[model samples]
Target: MDADRISKLPDHVIHHILSFLPTIDAVWTSLLSRHWRRMWYYVPTLEFSQFGNKDVEIFYNFVDDCLKHRMMGMHHNTMSVITRFNLNTVYRGRRSKVKLDRWLSFIAQPHLQKLVLNMFEYEPVRRRHYCLPEVVLNLASLTVLKLVFVELEACYPVSLPSLEYLYLGHVQMEDEILHTLLLGCPSLEELYIKDCDKLKSLRVSSSCLQFLDLSGNWETFTIKVEAINLQSFAFSNTAWKKPCSCRFDLASCKKIENLSLHGVSFYPDEDFASFISGLPLLESLALDQCDLIDIRNQHLKFLDVKTVRYKDRDQANWDEEDWDKVDWDEVDWDRIEISIDAPNLDSFKCYTKNLLVRFLMNSPNLSETFIHVGYCAETETRRREREREWIIVLIDVLFLVLLVELLMFPQVFRRNCRSPLPNVNKLKVEMGGYDEDGVRDALLWLAPSAETISIELEPF
Candidate 1:
């Protein structure tokens, strides 16, 4: 197609294509022709990046030109805007304050829905402050807000009636300031706080909050969450000095389905188990590196009357003497049952081989059982050491064959030899064939097709 013909596409189509490009690239389309010059101004999404140039003058000039273009043809509201203004005091140090104020004032439009501001290493250290004007709070149309490395002089305690998701990363604020913000957003559903070292306590009591993530903190912190409508929750890598405590007493969350806890420690298992058992409709539970206290007996009591028959022993002569020989004390059997309880009991998985065997032999009602071998570096190292010893014997036969070839068939080797003799290195590798055998044996004892075996090993 001809250039003129291609350029005659609808303005909406042009803006749609421009929306995918960086804001600077889209604005540069102004040089294409007069028709395309103002078209970039109407684009819905705006993204600007200032890199390599330490001078703030370049940033101010670029922003000024874009804003001037926007105002010249500005009629309708823009959908969303994402701007990354990297400023340095080298060139625009004298006009830094004026430029900063102007930049914030330019984008403080009520029509702006999503606003993202990222400023890195702006100088004139004393003047380096971001003031969110009261007009920002009045932007009722705005929903998602993200701020990075920006300091707020006063907590913008404005109610966001439309806000659903809020993310604050590396933003400094006091506990009271954060609480005020949370209290203002009545309809907030998801909140994420990461690397916010200044925050000490997060007191969240929202009726609409369904998901919450608190990770990466420098100092001790506590979170008081009371969300009756909450369904899914995740906690990762957060520390507390005096044992942080949280109370989840909301009963309105009857539909609460999934719970995931990562890198968290609870003092008492009874309290946690009781809370979990109360959720009648709960479906999935995931615990990763979580410290659960004294759960063995409680789990056994929960899975009462589930009988296990040893595959090697005949069912007719089964007695207590057969169970007495089993190492009941060493087997942490309760964790396996808790892992498998589905609508009471269905399937379960265990990391330890012995525990898995005991659970299979004990749980008569268990429909499926999975034995996951711990394949971390320690286990891999041990397996590799054994494999190396075994593979060495196999390689010895190859070495003898090579030595015989070199002595008896020197002419044959010389005719084919463009390269030197290959290095016979004894490399260590893990064999999953053994794990498959174990799974087969376990399956033979249980229902023939009831048990499925799968082995996943760590990458070399």
Candidate 2:
């Protein structure tokens, strides 16, 4: 087929093919011909990427022309959708900010559902930031909204009634402003906060929330999470050092299943245990690298807890002077109790080997248990190697001892040795004078009939 004729395929076929390419490549194809000129306008997604030292003006002009062409060709009732609009740009100066805002305004249409904005610049004195316009926020059809390196100021919170997922990465906003934004989205089910420096406190009471992730920030702030229908919660990062007190009071949510706590260093206070005990239907629980003071949950069917370790063996030692300086009696262990009511419990794992096995034996339903003693004095692998070495030495010594006894008195050794001869009719060799070697030879000679042989290396 000729290139000209192949390029004249129907609009539906062209759109289907263009959907696979990136938005930039799709838009560039418009220069092919008049038929292909307006093809990118009907494409369902748009992505703008600025690379190299290309002037910001050129990038803005390209984006502006693309938007105008799309809008002009779009039918009023046909609802042209930009399902995803991703912008990754590096601004050099203040001029780029104006161009960026203009580009956002042009593509900030009602049909845009998912929007991602990322900007990284190295101009210290310029102080660059992007503020999302109100029109982009008020889109009722937007379900996923992600903002990075942007500053969200205090304004009338835009209501996105249909938004179900929201991600804020490196976005500077106060706690109240974040709470207000969350409150506006009544249908939000998943929220992710990553490296949000200004976010201090998160007070949410969403019944529809199922997944949540909060990570980063060295600043200390208490989090108040109360989701009646939450199924999974994960927190990660070394900067999350603040002592947090969580209250899960959603008893009506019968579907609440999985809970995980990760990268938490501080020991949870006594109140945290009380909150965990209240989870009536929790199925699985995982605690990783968290200094937990007390954890007693009877309702969960599975539990896993692990602690961190140092690879250096020398660092594991402690001096007598260091021990004498601290008073260990002041520590509290009175509140510690191992109690659980998991009637359907199946698996349990703990890092503490000292954890009483009586707990597992007492449970009526527990089937499998894994106990990991962190970096033991002797690992299991080393212990097995030692055992194999001892067995080999023992076998060699026994063989030598028999040979010497047979060499001395072959017949006497055979008769008095009482080595429990096999019940073979042909092996009725008279018990006469025999040395260790003779007895060894006789045993070797009868090896063919020794279908099953028994030897006692040591007495009980």
Candidate 3:
């Protein structure tokens, strides 16, 4: 298989295959010929951009002639360094911030390991950021950092001893320079702070942090987390305009195992069940657009709840005639009474628009139950007979039940619905807008012991 195997490799493996192309195809491999002129300047990953340039001074003279041919090819490759430098710009003024601080002090090299700065605002002017350069906190061989709309300043013996993955969007630090940039990244492990609103109050003392994503700190005034080997935690302040008297303290996270809260609004000195019972290894919990009254956990298996369509937040600050002066059919379906004593709960997924969710208890290790409804479940035909009598008294012992999926939109059904879907081994019904008298009243109230039954209808 050697038909001139990629021009017979080895110039550092063809500069690591042109460092994964595109710096305009790695400068068109120097017009491919004389053994590929200068091998794309010993590529070790240098990405520049102006995305589909519309003459932003020819992308600032093509990144100033590719950093002057990578500093004159470092006098003929003296062990070429640059290990990944991505700069995504939209051309700001002041000579593009002095050529982006002279191309980040010419890639503060120590063999830089992954750095991406995405400065946006591609034209409809007035919104300039980009302020980070104390030689980029002295990049001591960084290990993955993505900052967008930058502006962070903290000059204090910052360390960075081999940083490990940090992503900050809409950044603009100053909470003591974000606690000296997380105490100078001591072996940081996956941190993503999104939509940063100048971080009001934050403290994440990490000891090799596992993974933490905190979103849009609206008026964040308290988020003191002490990661004791944190294993996945996510928090979202749902674009805060109100409901964000922020306070999230992950009680010294005891090896948490995946917890996600979107549009979070937890108060009362933040005792969301003593921070989820001190995370005795939480399994999985996701609540979108908050407000799930009370949830008890015993190593939760998986629970997802969705409901909070605040006009899809910020549709240009929504005002399509104030959504026709609100009156979604007198708007009140009252059913936010949720109480779960997760006795090793298996799986429960729910997406609602007309609330009415009542599962006080009884999921003897439920197998899988997914219910998604937006409307027309016959306008809650008497709350679907008390939600099918508490879903057959919550899966009568779930004989290792397989699957039960139901998604309705325009469909509606109501019938005697005798006892059959108890040990649901498989039953699926998804309809967006259907009529056959709504799948014959959802097959006469879906009595399924399941020998396989699938009904999907969603066209229109």
TM agreement with the true structure for every prediction: 0.61, 0.66, 0.31
Question: So what's the TM-score on candidate 2?
Answer: 0.66
Q: How far in Å is the alpha carbon of 253 misplaced in model 3?
A: 13
lDDT of each: 0.53, 0.62, 0.72
Across residues 1-460, which tens digit of lDDT does each residue of candidate 1 receive? 4468748898779888887887788888889887876777777777766665466567668878877767766655443332322222222233654665676677766666676665444553653445445555555666777766555545456767777888776676778877777777888899888767777666787889988777663334456677887777655555432223344443555555665554454544227666666666565555543434212111221221222222233431435466445443332222222332233333444343212222213333444433344322224555454334433432432232222121222345445733121233222222322344444443233222433333443443
Output the worst ten-in-a-row residue range by lDDT, candidate 1: 293-302
Ten-residue stretch with the least lDDT total in model 3: 400-409
Clashes of each: 1, 18, 0
Candidate 2 stretches greater than 4 Å from native: 1-10, 31-33, 51-57, 75-79, 91-93, 121-128, 240-255, 265-269, 309-343, 348-460
Candidate 3 C-alpha lDDT tens digits along 1-460: 5476776787888888789876778888788778887788888898877878778888889888887888888777777668898988874656678888988898888888899999885453565677777777768888898988877866555778788999998887777788778888899999998878777888889889999988874744577889899899888875634446657777888888888877666666566766676788898888875654466778889988776343334422445576556555444445555566777878878776544555565456766777675653334565555556556544432222322223222233333335434456677655555564545444434544566666776777
Candidate 3 vs. true structure, TM-score: 0.31
Which one wins on TM-score? 2
lDDT digits (tens) for residues 1-460 of candidate 2: 4467657677767777887786778988878878777778778777778775377677777777877777776765274667778888875555776777777777677777888888765573564656666767777878888887777877866789889999888777899988888888889899988888666667876878888877775435456677777887766654323323333334444556777766554434436565566676778877765545345566778877654322332322335456455333232112112344455666767664222212312344665555464432444565454335433433332332232232223555456743333344333232334443445465644343565333323322
**Deviation in Å, model 2, residue 111 alpha carbon:** 1.7
Q: Among these predicted structures, which one has the highest lDDT? A: 3
